[model samples]
Target: MARRRRPKRSNKEARRRAIYLLPNLFTTASLFSGFFAMIEAIDGNFLVASAAIFASLIFDGLDGRVARATNTTSRFGVEYDSLADLVAFGAAPAVMFYVWALRPLGRLGFLAAFLFAACGALRLARFNVQSDSAKPSKHFVGLPIPAAASMLAGTVMMWTQTSLVEPIPAWVAVAMVFVLSFLMVSNIPYLSFKSLGLARLRSFNGLVACLLLFVLVALQPYVMGFALLALYVVGGPLGARLLERGKAEKEQAEQLEHKPDHS
Candidate 1:
């Protein structure tokens, strides 16, 4: 008999076997959005730049969910997400704010922006190494990069709505940059969205409630964003303490439950 020939594996199958592409592609797009945001800021289009940062935030949020939903989570995906986040949430916002508002403050402005970028990188790196981290708590140990960037973006949007058309005051911009930068790497606890797990929701009402709130916010963005972001910033420490209290109560209950009856 003639020797049997083996069929060649198609490139698609080979790639599917070798790596997860969808989430990585999303991460790439997120990183690109950040870069484009910087370009827009450089061109003096602050509105478009802020919009791009928000665009990146959307993509950044999707990448992880896609990875988990598809059961394609991997170390590569995790690290890539972190790096993309640093660019999208850290470096881009800092640079955009620097050119748009902080640049007028001389060296102080430059240093403030630099500090924000550096702290973002540090925050990401620390997150990566904390292997035993409790399941995404109701809070974070510091200001999440995306939230800090969102606040900056929201502030710019608010400014655009005001009568003061001149560039933001140099001192205020400089001060804000430093404050936000410090928040990025600080030990202060901040809320994480994971406490409300979508998968475990018992009814559609939860989803409906969320959608309605989102609609309201979209209708009045400036005021809503300001209020929401302000609450988010302040809620972190409060949330953390609440979480700790909950944990302690559960532990105490468990201990009591384990005690033997004295008959």
Candidate 2:
């Protein structure tokens, strides 16, 4: 009997499918981390749960970059990423916070957690719609859900690890949750840092700054991480306000300069 031959197209299809799975694998890892976070939170392993959420953040970041690099971007991947983000950044953080800090607040605690998750979902939906219709920009239309989650996670990690840090009051935790949830759904622009072009940087000062940042972070990961995330959360509104003020002052100067010689 003649030997049977497999078609070359089948091999190509298999290879393509494998490539596509690479990014989705990262997405799966992120989802698993988020699920693990919730389980750990329930088990009273708050530190581990916080760390798991951070791990999910890493995986979540990698998936999109991997997809882009591999030319495997698809609508399915986009939708999948968003869904995973809601689980990892939205539900996971909410559950972690509720268990670790918000539990004492009773109904108010759970409600704050719910608000965070709901705002995160709404933020993701808005991001998806904007991404499809709007021109690419360096800023996000609202606080990214992952960043919000990371802020909460960083707070937990800092509180758990540092002796100098005081325990957050119940009301303060509730307020923090409410603020983060509002920021997620707000229209304030947040720097996405996507166009920073760090890979293509040639400045020696930039390299030094990057090295210094790494050293600082390495020395006190929990404290430094929380500080950096807090700065980013505050920077959005501060930057916008500064820009608006500058524009207004420039317009005023122009108006004065153009005034007739009535004076």
Candidate 3:
């Protein structure tokens, strides 16, 4: 009687089959934090819930960086991260805003929250389907979902930190939510800070500016963080306009330079 030997799995195939745990672990933790935030908000623990959103942001950033650093990037990981972001940065903030302050606004509040969530979802979908040529742009095609969510979370947190007993007015909440929602799906170009090669900053002034910015943030995080986020939100549209004007002027000058010598 002869026994047959089975073919063994090759190392390359085995590696491919094995999911990389490190980056995905960060993503899972981010997803959990987002859920925890929603639960906290539901339970009327707004402060802690806001902190959880911040924690999710940290984990979200770490996961992508870890994937790149470890050379363990996978399509599976990218899709997983996107799902986590939708929960953490889109749904979580929307829920928190609704539970914490928007509830008092009644129908308007719920609608606003829904708008934010809907826009965030659309933003994520557009990102997933974006063209390769558009992918390398130094600016985002629209306000990033995470940034919009962060602005909401940061505003709530700043209010609490400032010891404000009065809840945000219905009008204010409605306005903020709608503005943020529109920004999410807008074609306005938002600066992609990732395009800045931080590691390659060799200029002394750049180093100084970084240090100063850090000091500014450390001094009054609640005020400064919210201010910075607000600045970014407003800056995007303004920046896009400025860039457009520059381009138009450049084209006009080029056309004049090539015009026939009619004078």
Q: Which candidate number maximizes TM-score? A: 3
Best model per lDDT: 2
lDDT of 2 at 202: 100
Preferred candidate (lDDT higher): 2 or 3: 2
Clashes of each: 1, 0, 0
Candidate 3 residue runs with Cα over 4 Å from true position = 1-18, 131-135
Please, what are the lDDT tens digits per residue for candidate 3 over residues 108-145? Answer: 88989999999999998898778323647788889998
| RMSD list, candidates in order | 5.6, 5.3, 3.4
**Candidate 2 regions off by >4 Å?**
1-19, 164-166, 256-263
TM-score of each: 0.79, 0.89, 0.91
**Steric clash pairs (candidate 3):** none
Report lDDT (CA) for all predictions.
0.84, 0.92, 0.90
Return whichever of 2 and 3 wins on TM-score.
3
Task: Give the distance in Å from residue 57's predicted Cα in candidate 3 to where it truly belongs.
Answer: 0.9
Q: Write the residue-wise lDDT of candidate 2 on 10-31 in tens digits.
A: 6545554443688999999999
Candidate 1 ranges with C-alpha deviation above 4 Å? 1-18, 131-136, 162-164, 198-212, 238-263
